[model samples]
Structure formats: C-alpha cells, structure tokens
Target: MRNVSIDELDDTPRVVVAIGTDYAHGHLLARHTHRRAQLLYGATGVMQVSTHDGSWVVPPQRAVWIPAGVAHEVLMLGVSTRSLYIEPEAVDLGRQCQVIDVSPLMRHLLMEAVEAPLNYDEAGRDAVLMDLLLHELARSTHLPLHIPLPVEPRLLGLCQAFVQQPNAHQSPRQWADQLHISLRTFNRLFRQQTGLSFSQWRQQACVVLALARLATGTPVTRIALDCGYESPAAFSTMFRRILGQAPSVWLAATNS
Candidate 1:
C-alpha cells in the first residue's frame, strides 16, 4: 500500500483495513479525501494535519481520526505510519476529526491489521482482530492536540506568524499595536474568529510547537527558552498546566 491511493482502499470489503508505511522528514501529502474515515497513526514521529476548519498535531504514539470526505493534508516528520480506512457506517465515531492516544493493545492491533489481506475473512481470526481494533479505537482517549485556525484573514496571518516564532512574553497590547487595532477590539475579534482569546491561543500554539521539539529529543530547558519562556521552570509549569503533567512524564507515557 506504499503508493496506493486511499480511494483504492475504499473499495475494500472489510469493515476496517490498514496501510502501513513510513515517511521522510518534511514530506507533505497535499490535501485529499477518502470515501472511508481514516485513522492516521504515527508510531515514532509527529504529524501536523490540516483542513479548512482547523489544524491538529499528532505526537508520537498517537493517531488522528478523520471522518470520511474531509479534505485534509498531512505533513510527516520522519514518521512510521499506519493508516486505517474504515467504513463509517461500521463505526459509531462522530463526524469530526479527533486526536487519540493509541494504547498498547491498539498499537499491536494496528500493526497486525496491516498484515492481513484487504478482503479478510469475516468469520475467521481476521474478523476478531478487526473487531477488537475497532473496539479499542472507539474507546481511546482524546487529546487536546488541536490548534484552531482563524477565519479572519488578518488574524490568520498573525496566527501563522506567531506559530513560526512563538514567544510567551509578547503581550496582547503589543499584538494589538502591531495589528493597528485597539486591544479591546483585538481581543474581541480574535475570540470571534478563532473561538479563543489571545492568551489562550498563544498557550495552545506553544504546547503544539513544543511537542515536535520535545519528540526530537530536545532538552526541556532549551525548548522552553526557544519558545520565549523566561526559564525552564516557567515552561514546565505552563506545560503541566495545559497538559496536566511535566513534559518528561507526559512524553514518557505517550511513547511507552
């Protein structure tokens, strides 16, 4: 399935089937859609998935569930990926994209799935495997791994710029001044456009950026300073606040 189009998988009769492959760093798959919903999982790297509605970050050992017929593009960072295409009618997942943590059982199930024939036997071991896989997927935990993009063009530009060089110290007043809008107006428009306040958006962006950096074995201290935090302690504090644990503990659990 290395070079096969996802459309071809749509014709597969199985309720769920997988295509396992890997991508080099910085590889981009331009926007596309499939007839079946997809679980794009990366066992060893990060992926940034984007659609017209929003963008999501899938850190190592996790996956993103994309509903059928949504146009999305994926940028892979040296990932060992396993893609699952499922008949939406066969599953109860809602019609939205979500990031889910792949458990040990789910991980093994995915790897095993790619090894089975596309037209797998429905009354044999293959059926049981796929059934268990679907069960695990439906029960996986959702992560706060998404950063919604703004609909307003001017605000969109600002959001893109900030992502490129995020700094924790940049104040809302400074952003308002740069945009030549009053602080009150900026705050209101930002919330209206992105459904989040300036401060909230900044924190979300920082956490998303930090994930990729941390996955590459970068030190937490350096990641903090690079993201414009005053110190490692400050960065860890924020990281724990947003993610509910220190970076080391959080990442170890995910990777394990």
Candidate 2:
C-alpha cells in the first residue's frame, strides 16, 4: 500500500489534495493510502468500496468513508465522480472511517468546497464554512445501501446470481439442489455466511431492487412484479413494514 502525504500549503489550508477521476481504476491500477481522510461520492456514476472486514456499493445517493492511513480501494462502475478530500487534523471526525449517508446540505457544501478558491489564507470565510460543513456532515445518518460480499465461493456465486437477477423465482429447495446441497444444509449456509435466512435475504434483495426502480419512476405494480412479489399489495405491505413508509412516500421523500 502506498501513502500520499500532503504538506501544508502556505496560502490554502494545509490540505493535501489527491484527486481520482475514476476511483475504481485508480484503486485497481494502484493500491495506495494518503494522510487525508476521503469522502467518496459519485456525481453521476456508482462505485464500491471494500475494506478488510466488508465492502459497500456506493450509488449516487451514498458516500463511502476512507479513514486516513486505511489502505482500501474502490471499484467505480462509471465516471465523473465528485470525491471530497479532507485532512484528518482539520476535520474533527472520529477515528476509523466508514461509509456515511450524504445529505443534500452536505452535498452542497462539498460542491462549494470544490469551487472555493484554494488560497493559503487561513482568514478566508471558506474555512469557517468548511468547518461548519464538516460538523453538519458528522450528524448525517448512514443507510445500508452497500451489500456485503461473502468469501465462500458457493455462497458468493449464489449471491451474485441473485443480485444480478433479483426477480428469479427460484425456491430455496431448487437453489439447494442446484448448489448440490440439501435444503437444511443450504439454509444453514445462508445463515452462517449472510446472517440472514434464505427468505429474508431474498426479500431484502427484492426490496433493494424495488426501491431503485421506484426511484426511477417505475410503477409500483410493475416494480413489485419485477421484484418477484405475487402482487403490488404484498410488496407494499412488506415495503411499509420494513421502511415505515409506502413506496410512494419513500420516493417522494427522496425526490423532495
């Protein structure tokens, strides 16, 4: 792992800047670290950030945290990312970084930071605004949008297939047979690896897909069917139970 140290600038705040155009390729091409903590969010595309313990896929609505000195990398699926780079000493965030939800205000502050002049003058108003921005950012709630990946080859393959084709109407028994395992054995494996039962995992996966589709203006009936729900009512019941809001409400909240 390579570490990039940023020296204090005489005019601008002593923030070392390391910009990654496509963080996925940057991480793939080189596995490195830096003194600055990173708040990685996509301006348009999505990316996945993986640490030793877990991995998180960051869609446009989420951001992943990379603590200073943590040797982690990203897998970007697209381009034009607006990653925010912050110095550890300058910001008062707790040690050990993790993926955090980015609020609209935080997003605006970050874009403001990018546009702010990089002068070394400590007396500039940008410093005050940046500090306030960081404080506000620390209060944001993180959503579990990042799906964790399992190491077991059988489990991993099964999960990948499920995520790629979430609407597949395969029964647990069928999946167990396909995996050359008994129903009981396969159920145990799912609990062991994902800490969720087969049905629970499938439901969550289906809801994840449904949420994304709904955000894109997909009809509830269509999304419910596409996500393997018997009907929109069943999907709505499940959705309301898990999210505490209906599909329309959730979509409206996000869009608003």
Candidate 3:
C-alpha cells in the first residue's frame, strides 16, 4: 500500500506485497536485509544500491532486483519508489543483484501494484496483475549498471577511492604501482576479482558515476570534465558507446 512499511506486513500470507515510498533529496537507507526478494523500482529520480559485493545505479524508470537475505544499503536521490517484496518460493529473479530495464507496461504495473491490497484476493484481478508483473520481471533485460568490488583490502581501497572521484584518465599502472605489484599481476588479479579488465571497469565506474549527477540536471560539459574527459564530445562518445545513447538523449528518455 502507499507509503507503508513492508515490515508491518512482512508476514502477510500473500505471495507478493507492494509498497510505495518517497524520500527527500539525498536520503540514505542504511544497510539492511529483508526476508523476501525485492524488485525496487524508482518511479522518479535515481537510486544508488550497494551490497558487500558491488554497487548498482538505478536511473529513473529502472529497477534493481535484490535477492532475499542480501544485506544492502540504498541512497535515494529525489526518489519515489514502488517496491515488490516477493515470497522466495514464488520467484527466482537471480542470486546476484541486478539493475534491469523496465518496459512502459511494467512501469505501469508497478505503480498499480503499490495500490493493491496487502491481502489482495488470490483469485481475482489483483492476482492476475501480480502474475503478469512477475512474468514481465522475468523477461526484463539486465543492464550493465553494476560495478563489482574487489575483496582484497588494498585493491578494494583503491576501487572505493576511485568511485568517489572517478577519472577517465586514471591508468591501471598507477593502481598497480600503488599496490606495489607488477602490471601483469595487477591485470590478472583485477580481472579475477571483479570479472572485468581494468580498462573496462574504469570506464564503467566513470559512466555509472556520471549517471547520478546527470539525473540531477548536471550539464554534460561539467559532468564530462568532472569524470576526467577532455571534452563534452569525448564524454558523450564514451557514454554512447557504453549505454547506446548520448547522455542528454538518455536522460530525456528516462524522464519522458
């Protein structure tokens, strides 16, 4: 139900419980875990979700699938959220957290879901809607919005620092030197730990960080320079290459 806490109804017999909540700008929900799987959709603004393993940025009109019992924290940027807490046995989105694309139909369904009763009838329109929503979620496309973190203390510190002040020009050799390891060893270890090459992860970090600012109406030129790009054109090229559209175009679509 609207503006309700899931904890109040966590034991409800329904297979799925929906809730809608709004957060002020720059609100943070500290680390917490849930007994049920969650499909957290941002109807507006951006969401930054972090777990022990990685971080995900969910832009407007997108959602993140958080598996049951996964401890995570969320930072909401002017966000209004529609969340689905599903019984673990009712669906298996996946074991890992994911940022998924929400179709227009799915978006409408999520808004409608938050209006359904906590104890919605099992053999009625609400049940049918919930079933359709689950089907839509299963077919949703996963996005490359996740930045996996390394477990090693030294490398993890470096990764965390870079995320705070991302720079496109940061070189792998620099990180290797800081870790006091040879470039060869760093490359191998970086891939093994994060499942991506150093260069690939660097680009991803820059793009994901840019998205948070972009959602707040930051200008492209400013964001480009902040991300260490030489020019807005250069930044847009990289943004398009990774996300398939220029930053402005993508933001427009997300807001539309």
Candidate 4:
C-alpha cells in the first residue's frame, strides 16, 4: 500500500502531501531543513531559493524542487506557494535544487493538491491526482536560473562585492585588479572556484539580481541602468539570451 502525509512516518513506496501558503512582499524564510523532499510552486509572484551550493530564481508559473535534507531558504517576492512534501524514496529528483517551468496542467494540479487531506487515500481520485502531479514534476524542464557561488575566501569576497553592485560595464580585468591579481590568474582561478568563467559568472549574477528586482514592479529601463547595462535593449537582449524570454514578456506574464 501507498501513503501520503506531510510528515514521514513510514518507508512507503508512494507518499506525497501538500500545503498552501501565502507570503507578503520581502518575506524571508530563514535557512531550514525538511525531512521530506519538497516541490514548491510559485503560482503567483516570484521566489528565490538559496542553498550553500547555489541560488535559483523561480518566476511566476514556475516551481522549484528541493531534495530531502538539503538546507535551504526561500525569499518570497509576493508569491503564493503550494508546497508538496514527498518521501525521499518516492522520487529520485536528484540531490540538488532545481527551478522548473510549471505547465498549465501541472499548475492546476498543484492548486488541487494543496486542498487534499493530510493523508490522501491511495485508491481514490486524490491518488490519481497525486500520481499525475509527480509525473509532471519529474518531466518539467530545468531552467537556467542558478548562480553557483565560490568557496575560496578571497574569491568569495570579490563575488560578494560584485553581487552588491553589479555593473555590466565592469570587466573581469577591472575585478582582477581590485583583487590585486593578474587577469590570467583571475580567469583561471575564477573558473576553478566557481565552475564558470568570470564573464559567464557575472552575467549569471546580473540576471539573478535583475529577476529579483523585476519581481518588485521595477521597470526594465530603470533596472537595466541599475544593473549597469548600457541600454534597455541591451539588457533585454541579454535577458532573452540567457533566460529565453524578454523581461517585459516575463514580467507581464507573471503579473497577469
């Protein structure tokens, strides 16, 4: 027999339970851990999930899967969340956090799942609905919304500074000089530490930060300037290139 409960009390082959919650703008759920793997859907607004490994941004109509026992924190940018708690044995969603697009069907199913009883019946409609939910989550596309952070002390310092003031106009050479290192050393060590080239890492940082700001009703024109893009079109171009959707289109869709 299968089982479903927000709390794990057995080693069942199929277990999934859900809960619905809302958060006001700028709400932050401090670092925490859960016994069950979680699939959190941002039915409205946007969400930012961070772990020591990396950070992921979930825009509206998107969701994030966090593996069981991984420590994480979620920052809500005016989003309502429908969170599914699954027994680790029930799914192999990898050992990392992932942001994924929510299909229209999956979106509706999540809303329906949240209203389900604490322990859903295995032979009922809720079971079928839960099965479909798991299938959709496993098949969802993984988005490119992650920014992996470095662990080296000096590089970590530089990364922190860069994130604080993301200037697209700033070059790797300039950053290297700030750290008193040669451009060649900076290039090599940056990739070694962050698993991405300096330019690539900077772009990821910019996009992540830009998404958070955009979620709060900031205009593309102003955000571009703040993030140090030369022009709105340039910013949009990079946003589309990296995220596969224009800023205006994404912001509009999320708000609608």
Candidate achieving the largest TM-score: 3
Tens digit per residue, CA lDDT, model 2, 1-256 = 0122233322234452423343443344235676677777665455656665445555555677778777776666543455556777756555544657778887776666655555524567777666766686678676644455567887788778877777637789987998898999988987888777777777666665565556446799988887777988888988787567788787776555
TM-score of each: 0.92, 0.68, 0.98, 0.91
Question: The CA-based lDDT of model 3 is what?
Answer: 0.93
- What TM-score does structure 3 among the candidates reach? 0.98
Q: Which lDDT tens digits does candidate 1 get at residues 86-136?
A: 888877677768889888899998888888887889999989998998889
Q: Judged by TM-score relative to the true structure, which candidate is superior, 1 or 2? A: 1
lDDT (Cα, 0-100) at 251 in candidate 3:
90
Evaluated at residue 76, the lDDT of candidate 3 is 96
Clashing pairs in 4: none
**Of the candidates shown, which would achieve the greatest lDDT relative to the real structure?**
3
Tell me the lDDT of model 2 at 218: 74
> In model 3, how large is the Cα lDDT of residue 229?
92
* Candidate 3, run of 10 with poorest lDDT: 1-10
For each candidate, the alpha-carbon lDDT, in order, equals: 0.86, 0.64, 0.93, 0.84
Error of 3 at 211 (Å): 0.7
Give lDDT tens digits, candidate 4, residues 1-256: 1223344533444588677778888899899888889998887888989998878888887889999999999989888888888888877879989888888899899989878765678899999999998898888898878888888888788787877788888888987898899999989998998889988888888898888788877789998999888899999998898888999888887777
